[model samples]
Target: MNINLNINNKIYNLQVDVDEPLLKTLRTLGFKSVKSACETSNCGLCTVLIDDLPHLSCTILSVQCESKKIVTLEGLSEEVKIIGDFIAEEGADQCGFCSSGFIVNVISLKRLYPDIRDELFIKNYLSGNLCRCTGYEGQMRAVRKYLEV
Candidate 1:
């Protein structure tokens, strides 16, 4: 199928397979940040923003995103850096395999709830994104630090 998708504020013309996951489509288009640890949406490593909300790219079909706006980690570099600085300072960023998805979700969290300051609420908001290394405490601390700024 041939479709036009608005990704990272740019239009892309792509010919994709009917059953191809958006994760693969995006990687094919050089959006390497959209990685996949589990294609079943459990890992959240393939997360991307669909109309400003986090969605597992591995579970979404390329054709389904034809008319929607998609934002990958590449599109939100500055926001990523804003949060990443805290994550790094807090020592939450480890291995870096899940950084893209984790950062994307963090950005979404802030956008979705601008006034969020509760630690529990922040934890629950990012429950879907799993990182094997830091065990979440560092990430949580990083988020708290970011929110304070």
Candidate 2:
């Protein structure tokens, strides 16, 4: 079946199965920035903004995404660049696999809780995402920088 996908403010006609996960469809459609790690949703690598909220693309059915505004890392390139600059300054970006999802998650969190500043809160907030590289210290630094901005 065909579904309407609103991505980065542009609409596209996506022909996909209703049960297909949004992540698969996204990757097939060229949104490769949406990383796929642990398709069970344990890893936040598949995170994407759906209707302005961070939703795990690995678990979300493609049909549910129809007519919804889906924002992937490609769409958030400017924000990711800003975060990347901060990550660079903090010596954070390593492996780069989890960067996209983490950045997207941070963007969503910052928008949702603009006044959040508790380190513990930030740590807990980012607990869902797993990064094998960088050891999370750099990740924390990047998050701190993002909050400052």
Candidate 3:
């Protein structure tokens, strides 16, 4: 089966099974930055920006994402560098498992809420992602600094 997808501002013709998860299809298509953790939607490791919003690729079907602009962490190299530098400065890259997903979400949040002003709001929004290492403090700090707060 051949399907057309717009990933990271590029068009791709993916030949994959219809039941394959978007995550698998993406990785097969060379989008390795889209991490695969929990196959279910529980983990945000497979998070991708769909239409500028964070969408878990593990939960979305490849066919359903035919026309959406899919932006993975690899696509956000500049933004990730900014966030990664902050994380390294704060010694936040412990396991490095959740960094990609967290960064994607932070980018999306900043784009959506340019003038956000609430600590609790930040905490609540990032709560969906889990990190066994580095804890949440470093992630929070990275977000705060990125948002210039």
Candidate 4:
């Protein structure tokens, strides 16, 4: 099947398997930042923004994303860079494997719920993304800083 995917502000019309995971298709197309630590969607490492919403690429078929706007970490806007910078400064990115997915979801959360500034809300929102490094303390601090700003 052929699908038209608008990813990172570029349109790609590529042929793909009907049952192929979007994560594979994206990585094949050079979107390496869309990592897949767990192909079963248990880990949020393969998360990507589909039409401005975060979705697990590993569980979603490439064909299912036809005509949708997909945004990976590479597609992050300047506004999100502030968050990234804060995270980096706070030493939140250890191992850095899950940073991209976490950042993508953070951007989604900010866009979806700008008024949710509580610490618990931030923690709850990021619960899906599992990070073995940094212990989430730095990440939480960065999130608090981002929300404060």
Top candidate, metric lDDT: 1
Query: What does candidate 4 score on TM?
Result: 0.94
**Model 3 lDDT per residue over 1-149, tens place:** 78899988889987878888999998888788788998888878888999999999999899998888989988999888887898888888887888888889988888898799599998877777778876688777878888993
> Model 4: which residue pairs collide?
none
- The residue ranges of model 1 lying beyond 4 angstroms of the native Cα positions read none
lDDT of 1 by residue, 95-149 (tens): 9998899889988988888889987888888888988887888888888877766
> lDDT rank, highest first?
1, 2, 4, 3
Q: Find the 10 residues in a row with the least total lDDT in model 4.
A: 140-149
Segments in model 3 whose C-alpha atoms lie over 4 Å from true places: none
Q: When superposed on Cα atoms, how far off is each prediction in RMSD?
A: 0.9, 1.0, 1.2, 1.2
Which candidate do you rate higher for lDDT, 1 or 4?
Answer: 1
Per-candidate clashes, comma-separated = 0, 0, 0, 0
Q: For model 3, give the 10-residue run with minimal summed lDDT.
A: 133-142
lDDT of 2 by residue, 1-149 (tens): 88888988999887898789999999998999999889998989999999999999999998898889999989887888888898888888778888888889999889999889999998898888888887899889888878888
Q: Quick one: RMSD of model 3? A: 1.2
Clashing pairs in 1: none
Q: Model 4: residues >4 Å from true position, as ranges?
A: none
Model 2 is weakest, by summed lDDT over 10 consecutive residues, at 87-96
